[model samples]
Target: MSEELGMREEPRGRLYRVTHRTVYEYDDDVTSSYGRGFLCPRDFPGQRRIDHELVVDPEPEDSSTGVDAFGNHDLYFHVTQTHRRLVVDAQSTVAVAAEQTSWANWDDWADWEDVRLRLAQEPLVRQYVIDLDPPEITDEVLRWAAPTFAARRPLVEVVAELTHRIYKELRYDPGSTTVATKVSEVLAQRSGVCQDFARLAIACLRGHGLAARYVSGYLLTNPPPGQPKLVGADATHAWAAVCFGEDRWLAFDPTNNQLVSDEYITCAWGRDYADVPPLRGVIYSEAKTSTIGVSVDVAEL
Candidate 1:
């Protein structure tokens, strides 16, 4: 089991209305569908979920909600009836607070290798130690991350340096890589989206025997200057969080080269994206071609 961060009773923050809608169109009828969604927000150090709802079209014959191993809320649903199109609309209202100061003096914290050994003794932290099955770690990744993580450097300092290096070195190309892309490919190409960057960061940390997990959530993005904010201009964002101790973890947005803050909303997190995709399912259909479109709006309320 994973640790549950204790959130304050009342945190200072702003309210946001998040609408995430996914539409799937098939060439032929879909006789059955089964899905697991990690769209609900989790209450943590600086965030709280006020209310949430999910609507599934062609209503599922069997559906239930439960907490996963990583303490993320998940919805399981299955559609037994026939259908050609599927729509999943998930909306949530959350209060996101500003980042709080670290509880422990980071400067006094032990070095990376010591912290790694300590984490190995904690069952909760050990869960995130393995490499992601798809994007397996390579020698190149370890080499790239080794310099920043000197044996005597403070753990947090080492993590910050590594994150900054990745931010500075990698180009943010939207379609440069896919979910199946390997970390070695990313290191070679030097370009990828937020998820790819997050994965790379995770691989780097994990290679050093550190515990790191993938964070999935929404980031508030501003509309272009002089233009009105578009209704669905926002998108679900990804980041990486590393275990500082049994009860403390630090999250960083390698995509934006900053620490996670009020502008970010955490939905769920686990070993990797494979554990907490917003929406993924199996469909029983003869459709040869299918298309998917996702629209997200994270509006301050």
Candidate 2:
């Protein structure tokens, strides 16, 4: 559903070259269009940004590049030329972040409830964990996440446990849900794509009064054994990151059921998918419909 949502858009243990291309075709001429997105990879802690570039077809009359409130690089553009097709191409070279996550290392870690209490006083992380809009957190969501937030369990442990549970129980059906699907609906359906899974995990954390964020990026997907890797076969990936305290965060991929490592690249992170989608735009035209296609490739260098 995320890919269909808007082909949302990461590896650093090793240097990587990532290419993302989005093409829009309109049924009739479009007089103007305005777009905003995260085309350049973010320079987060433990991550290195080597080089990056973005190209817009039809040559936008106005454009700007800057960092958003979340400190991620963002691009804004407006195309005024009359055209039937528009293209956005972004290429980035980056060295990925590598972090080893252990399940048995909780000696000094605070309890899940303790972390939640600490977060209640934090304003910096509140932006990422707040779930007021769309009503992602509900009674049902809390009830479903109740078992995982056990009494005095470590925060990271609770996060990882939910990650595994989602991966094991829910099916990864591409079309199971849509961009508008809520966490409650996803919980009831029991299946969805990366965005849905990531959102669900985030809802669980917020229900416990913890701060969790939605991550958008690219993941390296392998081909079947003995088969050549297909160019642009890799997809835009997503995951959830739980803020244990003000100083640290642990990210987990529920769809892949693992701790994020060098294989995943960081693009932009926000409270949810709507905040940092790869590309979203508004067009002024008489065109009745439009089609979008996104192609992504992650090559290790």
Candidate 3:
């Protein structure tokens, strides 16, 4: 059964009140295993000086649920503001509560070679692989990265396990790096934020001959009863997805050491953080400070 998903965004403390135009795109294509929706910035055309670009398709990678005999419905919303301290927010509500299944169950069924071969036929996805030139499976990197996962694992399992190991080996500090930070730099410090974890995972997956992409979105935090939702927890999160086999991709969160579940809501995706930013724009104001706030709650259907 699909669960209902909803997103709400509010902007406060505006510096500019310029009129903006935005678009929301949704795919009702039932043939595809994954349906996509997009939201564009309102005044992005006018304020191009900020070098801003928003990330869409931030959810973990998986097959389109549209074709599943079970039938799944997903919904998303995007909000944009043009005025002063640009405050852009987005919320996505998905109706299908994907069950929490063991990673092992998918191991035997998924075929990486077949997926890579088939994906080569698709122009866009194939171009992603060609353009990225994901890592080659060499003796050294494999040996070093191999120890990161348990024995007798699928490629996806290895990727997931290694990603978790990388997360555990690193620290979750903010100022340590920026979205533009390099994967090598993140590895050097062995500590960073969600974005860092995503970059690291992408880099590692690519090195292992897998096409992995970065995603930015919101996660439904396990909020305590009666207590208010956490501030930054609901704000923005980053994760990575790896192309397994046969055009099938799986979502993995190294930062959380788990696969994405119902609590995860995606907003955008891209080659890296530069592709998808929560809020980005240029302002005429000389001095500016920005603040972000987020809240999320889930009720059982």
**RMSD (Å) per prediction:** 4.5, 5.7, 13.8
Q: Write the per-residue lDDT of candidate 3 for residues 8-82, one digit (tens) a residue.
A: 232221121111122222222111122233222121111111111222232223322221111112223222222
The TM-scores of all predictions, comma-separated, are 0.89, 0.90, 0.60
Backbone clashes under 3 angstroms, per model: 0, 4, 27
Tens-digit lDDT string for candidate 2 (184-253):
9898989898899999999998877889999998875554478554222367888888887755888888
Give the lDDT of residue 11 in candidate 1. Answer: 58
State each model's CA lDDT, in order: 0.82, 0.81, 0.48
lDDT of 1: 0.82
| Candidate 2 C-alpha error for residue 105, in Å | 5.0
Better of 1 and 2 by TM-score: 2
Q: lDDT tens string, model 1, 113-169?
A: 888888888887777888765546898888888889887778888777777888899
Q: Using alpha carbons, what is the TM-score of model 3?
A: 0.60
